[model samples]
Target: MESPGRYRYRPANTLYAASHDWFSPYLSRPVRELLDAGPHARSLLRSPRNVDVCILFTDIRGFTDLSRTIGSDRLFRTVDACIGRQIRIIEHYDGYVDNFTGDGLMAVFEGPDMTDSACRCALEVVSRALPAVRYGEAALAPIGAGLHRGDVAMGTLGCESRLTHTAIGDTVNRAARLTGFARGRDVVISERIRRGLSAETAARFAPVQADRRRTDIDAIAPIYRSRCG
Candidate 1:
């Protein structure tokens, strides 16, 4: 057995370390605050709850095409750096990252201003990824984002040894489908999201014209596109 001194319980040290640990960045601010107060995994995820939140999904437009032009090593680094920047912007707007898909990410925003926060974050994400800064021999591609707001089941899954915190339901699906519809440097928002925005914010987005392409998708009609970026 290892010596007790090698890893003795130290509340202060553990709290400080936990706040800066790799896993900490993945947690929502409220969850991090809870863990900081009582550093316990059980308490952190004991109860599942339904929450009203804005979900945003972003993906690099034409990523598959971009991938073919770059080496794997450079592609990996470029994507990592790009995602890191987007995550910072998400947190800045009081949002939490849900998951990352190699060239994109899903984030959640809650609270009274969740709609505004998610909208602003999506716009910024598009703008931030617009500049093709060199990453060795490759560059990050411009991204497309989508936002929707609705109720979702938020909780942890899996056994004690390995748990994953995620949100599920039609709300999540719609947001992702909206992302698929977004064009490069565009922020596509569902009607629900557009309705939630403040007047001034809502005015910034233009209604997406209905076309055969969009009409074919389920529940994706009447979306709005923000071209601010």
Candidate 2:
């Protein structure tokens, strides 16, 4: 937890427009009139759009094969449980559950010293799912996670019936790619997010044994996070 004295913040007074779009205008109001001068705000407000330093994706491995074997009714139920456990873990770490896409989730953590926290969140998310899963015997196989810390365009992606307010950039793509690279329950964090990690946390991750032959077995992108040192 950060000290309360570290941050100062105020919410831009928001008003819903006649057109259904919303707007907030900064006026002559004193800085003391702020919304959530919480400790997290100091770091969250650093980048106007992207206080987000991490984007993690955790998907049940072999979902496709399972779907074919189990049939739709049982499969969707299984996927829901798998994703639900991950969402709960992400929220516990002060991370936002951006969206749940089928069996996976995109989580965004906004707070101070986020790089270290994000790494911990990813580990926790994968750890929690193992115990939460139950019959019809759904288990998390090869939990994959991608992490990146940087500025990303953030906003409501749509309106009315459908919407997603999320982080968008190559950083996000790269993280997802890292997840895709993971094998046998690998965490698969990227170079960028790895660099952001505290020295102690960085020590936890091991290097990907170089695949010089370019084999099909470990193909996705480059880089992967296998274990904690």
Model number with the top lDDT: 1
> Candidate 1, residue 210: CA error in Å?
4.9
Candidate 1, which ten residues in sequence have the lowest lDDT sum?
Answer: 1-10
Off by over 4 Å in 1: 1-23, 26-31, 37-40, 210-221
Candidate 1: lDDT over CA atoms?
A: 0.78
Query: Which pairs clash in the backbone of model 2?
Result: 142-185, 204-229
How much is the lDDT of residue 1 in candidate 1? 26
Provide TM-scores for the models.
Answer: 0.82, 0.69
**Top TM-score hit:** 1
Tens digit of lDDT per residue, candidate 1, span 1-229?
2212212232333563355788866665545554543455455466677888899999998889889999887888788778888888998998888888778999989888899888988888899754645765566667999899999998777886887778888899889988877887889998899988899888889987645655435643688998675
Q: Cα lDDT of all candidates, in order?
A: 0.78, 0.61
- 18-110, model 2: which lDDT tens digit per residue? 223232122101111222334533344333364455778777778777677776777777777777677667767766666666778777766
